[model samples]
Target: MLAMNYRGPYRVRAETMPDPVIEHPNDAIVKVLRSCICGSDLHLYHGLVPDTRVGTTFGHEFVGEVIEVGSTVQNLKLGDRVIVPFNVFCGTCYFCQRELYGNCHNTNPQATAVGGIYGYSHTAGGYAGGQAQFVRVPFADVGPTKIPDELLLEDAVMLTDAFPTGYQAAEMGDIREGDTVVVFGAGPVGIFAAKSAWLMGAGRVIVVDHVEYRLEFVRGFAQCETVDFKSVKDMALHIKKMTDWLGADVCIDCVGCEAAGSALQHLTGVKLKLQGGSATALHWAINSVRKGGNVSIVGVYGPTFNAVPIGNAVNKGLTLRMNQASVKRHLPRLIEHIQAGRIEPHRVISHVMPLEEVADAYHLFSSKLDGCIKTVLIPPGVTA
Candidate 1:
């Protein structure tokens, strides 16, 4: 089967790979119907993630039909369409019991520094990702969410990571009704942060980024204000002016590594103590929030230490909340919203192509094409 495989830095190709089969009795083989590139994928695309294996399949966000279920997999059966959570997890682990599936101890080895991630480092268990014709789903009963027939896979696929990550960032920031929020980075995940913040009853949302296209796109969604970081001499003032001279009540960072700064030099005042592509939008969020406020981060950082001044955050009474998405806790509700048409996340999906065109899609996504807010890979013969 042809898949998007990592060749080297800034290089992903459509190449033939071994067909997937059940590796564990609890595993299931999913015939992928739709898959999408994540902002994290860019970490490798830009040569940020170290020790990245060559020719490894490179994606985790996907929806698929169950081609075969393992002997112990009774909850999902063949022909069932489902959304696979980006984090492969066993539902019964200690972390999972606490509603934190992203840190499932079973899938992530006992001593994993960072939890397992699909197509990421071996520290992440190097599990094959969903960006292929078929994916081997570990802990199928616990990880792969069975999508209702009324729901579209393209819309729900983002639930695996992007939407859930965005929601987690906002929820962690402790957004309150009538609160004003600012989200750094206007990529897919950041856009979801804007959407989720408003859905949770935020009075105003400000999205900061240089991408005019994304800022313009945010207008289609109600109650969002956009700030082109390139145009501002003082981003803090720009945010304050939009929010009645008070800084944002809550802030979220969704574009992690890709949003690493020093790109905006015109801006004055406090800059997040960031260097190179390390601190990312999370640092910006910390700088953008009001004193005594909160900054939530869902952006994935590479394996490195960033110097965050704990004293500065403490002096201002700022709270920091961040994590990979705990999808198990939020998936059901997000899916329910999708099923109810309460959120049309599909608006972010701007491209669709056959699996054979996987390489082309990767290049387009890697380059961040004009119409490519998100690109979903539809396997052959996938209908609706």
Candidate 2:
């Protein structure tokens, strides 16, 4: 099978890999039909995430047809079309029981902070991802959901990660009716976060980013106001001025780890590998929201300290919430929204390439070239 092979920082290519087989009783072997390049995948591509071993494939958002299943896999069978969530979790664990599948304790023995994630890295349980012709899925009954007849495969693929993560970011905000919300970053997750904020009854939604194309895309896609952080002197101050000096009721950070703002942050965190990742977005969110307001973060950051404004957060009585999105937990409501035409998840896709061209797909997304917002990969032999 051909898979996206990780060589090192800024290096990935399509290479021959052995086809995956069922390794556990609950495992399933999925022949991938559609997969996507997620924003978080860039972190691994750039070597921002720790323990990302060489030769590992990197992808977590994928949908496929189940070609084979182990003895214990009862919910799925051969010929079932399914969409697998990013998280590799056991459903009966304490965190899973609470619907926090992203933090499941039974997977990823290397760390206790996060559960196993497909194709992330060794720190994420070293599980190979679906950026291949085939992938091994653990806890098949709990994680892989059969795609509904009414859903498009492209849409189902996006729901695996970006959509759910974005929706979860909004849910973490606990937005009240008529509240003013500001989202940092205009990537897929940020766009979805902004869109979901409206669904949660936010009176106004604003997206902050320095990229001109992304800002324009989010304005049309999320139907929200846009701000180019590069044009402003102080982003936090600008947000305060926009809100009549009261600041926004809620602020979200969708640009994690690789946030490009502040010379010191970029030099130390992203360049020097000193901290987990740049905390520029987190800094902006902490200082930009109204005192006693809510702040939600769905950005991917490494397990380490960031130079954040803890003193200001404590002084201003802000409510800070963050976590990896529990994709399984949000699927039902999101599916309803998609089916109802309230949210078109596939609209975010800007490019689609054959799986054999996986390397070029990565370059396009990583370089943000060709007005790319999202890119989906089609496995060999899959017509769609």
Candidate 3:
């Protein structure tokens, strides 16, 4: 088997690796049909995430078929088309009982510190992720979901991460019907955040990103307004003026640290603040919200501390909820939406390449070249 390995900063290669097997009773193995290149995966490539191996399998978003199952896996079966949740978690843990599946204590080795994530880092579960032909899945009954045959693989691919994550950010942020919502970062997650804001019944969904292509892509969705942050110094005022000075009711930050291209923009200086204030999407979202509005953040962060504006949050009586997706809780509902064709998350994908060309795809996605909004790496023989 060949896997994309994180060799060092800005270095990743498609390298041959041993095949994975079920190491636990709750484990299942899926033959990856379509995997993705995520913004967070760039963290591993850049060597920003600590404890990850130089050559750990490196992707988190995917859809695939269940080729094998474990003793405890009752609900899932062989030949089932499924979406692999980015996180590997035991269903019966203390945090799992509270629906915080990402923080599950049993599966992840670093469970004492935080939740475990696939293809994320050693700090997570260190589970080899789905950036290749086959991936080991833990807690299959609770982890993977079977999709309808009528639904496309690409549709299910999104459920694994971006789509649900974008929606989860808004859900945790307390987005409501007819409320004005502003989402920062028009990247994949940001676009999903904007779509979820509208689906959750936000009166107006406003998106912020400097990329012309991304903001333009958001236009296909109904009832959306967008802003290029590079054009505005005072983002809050810009949003307020667009909203007739009413401000938004909820704001979501989906960009995390890597906005536009790389989170280490200041360190890399390659793009020169590629997305500008998008680096502080949270700060802008908090400022753009109405006095009592809610702010939700869903971007993946490095294991470090950065100064957040507590003063404004305290003074305005803002409600804040920020974290990774509770995939167990969010996945089922998203699956239903997919079955009904209420939303087509696949619209965000701009390219689909064969699995063998994984290395080329990564370079394009990292460089943000060729108008690459999203790229899905299909298995070599995947038939259209």
Candidate 4:
């Protein structure tokens, strides 16, 4: 099997690796038909996430056909087309029983925070991802959902991570009808969050980003306003002005550790490794929401401490909610949204490349080249 190999920072290649076999009674082997290079994958590509081993593959969003299943995997079988959630978990655990699949206690029990994440890093259970011809899915019964026959492979793949994540971000915001919601970042997650805000009855939705193409794309896709943060002198102040000086009713931080706009944050967090990725977007979120408003975070950040505006949040009485998207929990409702044409997840895909060019795909997405919003990688023999 050919898989994306992580060599070092800013380096990756397609290399032949041993095919995965069922290792646990609940395990299954999947022949990947479609895989995605998520925005969070750039953290590993840029050597930000801790303990990302050199030989590990990096991908979490994927849809595949089950080729084999273990003895205990009764929910799935050979020839089943499924979309595997990014989380690997045992469904009977305390957290899983409560529908908090991302924090399942049985998987990655060594960590105090975050559960098993496919292809993230050692900190995320060290599970191999689906950025290859095949992948091993653990706790298969609880995670993989059968893809609806009417759903496109592209949209089905997004359900594995991006769509659910974005929806969760907005869901956490607790947006009230007629409230003004502001989203930070215009990546696929942010775009989805902005769109979800509308579905949640938000009167106004504004997406913020430094990239013109992304800002333009989200404005159309989400049917909301956009702000190019690079053009503003002070992001928080600009957002306040947009909201009539009282600030937005809700603010979302979709941009995590790698956020720009702060020289000090970039220098100390990103370049010096002094803190978990930059907190620029978080700072804006804390400072730009109205008093007593909500701040929802779906952005991926390191486990280490970040220089955030905790004081401002406390003083303003803001409700700050954040967590990895419980992809399994949101799957059923999101499937309905997709099937009804309420949201077109595949429209976010700007590029589709062959899995053989995984290296180039990484560079293109990380560099934000070619107006790339989302890139889906198709395995060598698979057709998009």
Give candidate 3 regions above 4 Å deviation.
111-113, 260-279
lDDT for model 4 comes to: 0.92
Candidate 1 collision pairs:
none
Candidate 2 local lDDT, 1-384, one digit each (tens): 999999999889998998998789999999999999999999999988988899999899999999999999889989999989999999999999999999999998888879999999999999999999999999999998889999999899988999999999999999999999999999999999999999999999999998899999899989999998878999889999999999999999999999996788888888888888999999999999999999999999888778889999999999999998999988999999999999899999999999899889988999999999999998889897
Lowest lDDT block of 10, candidate 3? 269-278
Q: What's the TM-score of every candidate structure? A: 0.92, 0.99, 0.92, 0.99
Give residue 192's lDDT in candidate 4 (0 to 100). 93
Q: How close is candidate 4 to the true structure, as a TM-score?
A: 0.99
Q: In the order shown, what is each candidate's alpha-carbon RMSD?
A: 3.4, 0.7, 3.1, 0.8
Model 1, 206-284: lDDT tens per residue?
8888877777887675348877777887766677677667678998877665553564421211133233245646656
Candidate 1 vs candidate 3: the lDDT winner is: 3
Query: Ten-residue segment with the worst summed lDDT in candidate 4?
Result: 261-270
In the range 120-173, model 3's lDDT, one tens digit per residue, is 878887888888888888888888878877888888888888888888887877
- Tell me the whole-model lDDT of each prediction, alpha carbons only: 0.77, 0.93, 0.79, 0.92
* Residue-level lDDT tens digits of model 4 in 58-102: 899999999999998899979999999999888998899999989
Off by over 4 Å in 1: 110-113, 263-276
TM-score pick, better of 3 and 4: 4
Q: Worst ten-residue run, lDDT, model 1?
A: 265-274
> Which pairs of residues collide in model 3?
none
Q: Identify the superior model by TM-score, candidate 1 or candidate 2.
A: 2
